[model samples]
Target: MIEEIPSEPVVITHIIHETPSIRTFEFSRRFEAQAGQFCMVWVPGVDEIPMAFSAGNAITVQKVGEATGALFSLTEGDVIGIKGPLGNGFSPEGRVLAVAGGVGAAPLRPLVTYGQADTFILGARTAEELLYAGELAGKAEDLRIATDDGTRGHHGFVTALLEEADPASYDTICVCGPEMMMKAVLGILDAHGVADRGQFSLHRYMKCGVGICGSCCFDSSGLRVCRDGPVFTGDVLLRSSEFGRYSRDAAGRRIPF
Candidate 1:
């Protein structure tokens, strides 16, 4: 079972507006989390949502639905329940390529901090959605940004920029994003014959992040997302048909990806 951290209500000390819909909330105290560890956040009467831990006990929240909406509605002094630093995290070294899509940059940011050196590629639907540009600049050896629209950087998916990059220069690649985006990244690496050098972070609906309810388990393999991962090696992901193909909802029903 995964352990929950803080063990008490945590107060929000500060907040940074990353985008109109995304915000990074800093807790009153540091959580000592790792590169890819996540926290189960409980918001009073609202729902509990899992979020990747950012720097200094912070968690970036993107207002995507009711749960996030409720979380975002809180004021600076508001308190929330936090449970985690759960699951495995990245241990990247040497020349690294850190890839992020949309709010997926939240988790990768900590990974970059841990690595201390990396080339970061951040993407979003528009330039406005691109996050942590300056923060990443201080940590990344090189930083690239992309948007689907012509709003910023490359006028296409970040993967397009990645293709133009000399992937052979990096010892490893760490990626987190929408399933489709991750799939595309995997494909590009495969085509370039560097598939083995990638690590992918995946998301699925969760009820109990401690691996008790078995809600985050994958089909066929019995691998629990809350326990076995949220992050997986390129080899494990490549071999799993479900990697980019399917997921379960809150009801544990198979849903095509």
Candidate 2:
């Protein structure tokens, strides 16, 4: 078996400005990882946050929180630490329908690039926020876009586009986005009787990327997002008490959505 790598410092090789708010950081040391698995990114003195791979040695970050703000201030040659390509990833098989919202598109990018997905629907607040449309258009057999501001192909939620499509037609449906969005997608897929075909990626407060800490644990299920998943099947999510309803804070306190 290959030796498991531990947390180690890495230098940023380059950065790509995907959008005004989103950036992709490429590291000097390359590693192997599946699409949906995540790494614990340590920002030196700031904090450590879990980030999913956009590539083998790269992470796509959206400037949203304090940890990410610190990440945004760094430039090429800056140092950070990474631990694990931990948690189960999507094992997409056969024809796939991929749906993503906002920065959630980053993780699903690999699936399309590998020719696993036939259709991709990307939703954002506006046209400018739509991530990787040009790159994905050429990769996916059918690429669709939806924006809340009517600035793109479909002027509504991504869920609306999903409803229009044949959910049962695809062998697998992969999704990652805001918890509310994924929850809505699950409901739709359930209505179509294809809930079992869906796979969803979820994010929760994570202190340990190795599942030692219970910070990322799903309510009642005792499933740890850092280990058991960042990706879960539709059936598992449907049964989760905390799936879309609420999430834990840094203190492990439940915060309702």
lDDT of 1 at 42: 87
lDDT of each: 0.83, 0.89
Clashes of each: 0, 0
Model 1: per-residue Cα lDDT over 180-231, one tens digit each: 9999999888888888888787888998777888988876677888888888
Per-residue alpha-carbon lDDT of candidate 2 for residues 1-257, written as tens digits (9 for 90 to 100): 33455888999999988888999999988767888888999998999999988888899999998999999999999999988788888889878999999999988988876788889999999998888878887778899899999998899999999988888888899999988999999999999998989999898999877877688989779998988899999998888888889998999888998
Candidate 1 accuracy as TM-score: 0.94
Predicted structure with the largest TM-score when compared to the true one: 2
Give stretches of model 1 more than 4 Å off: 1-6
TM-score of 2: 0.96
Give me the displacement of residue 225 in model 1, in angstroms.
1.0
TM-score of each: 0.94, 0.96
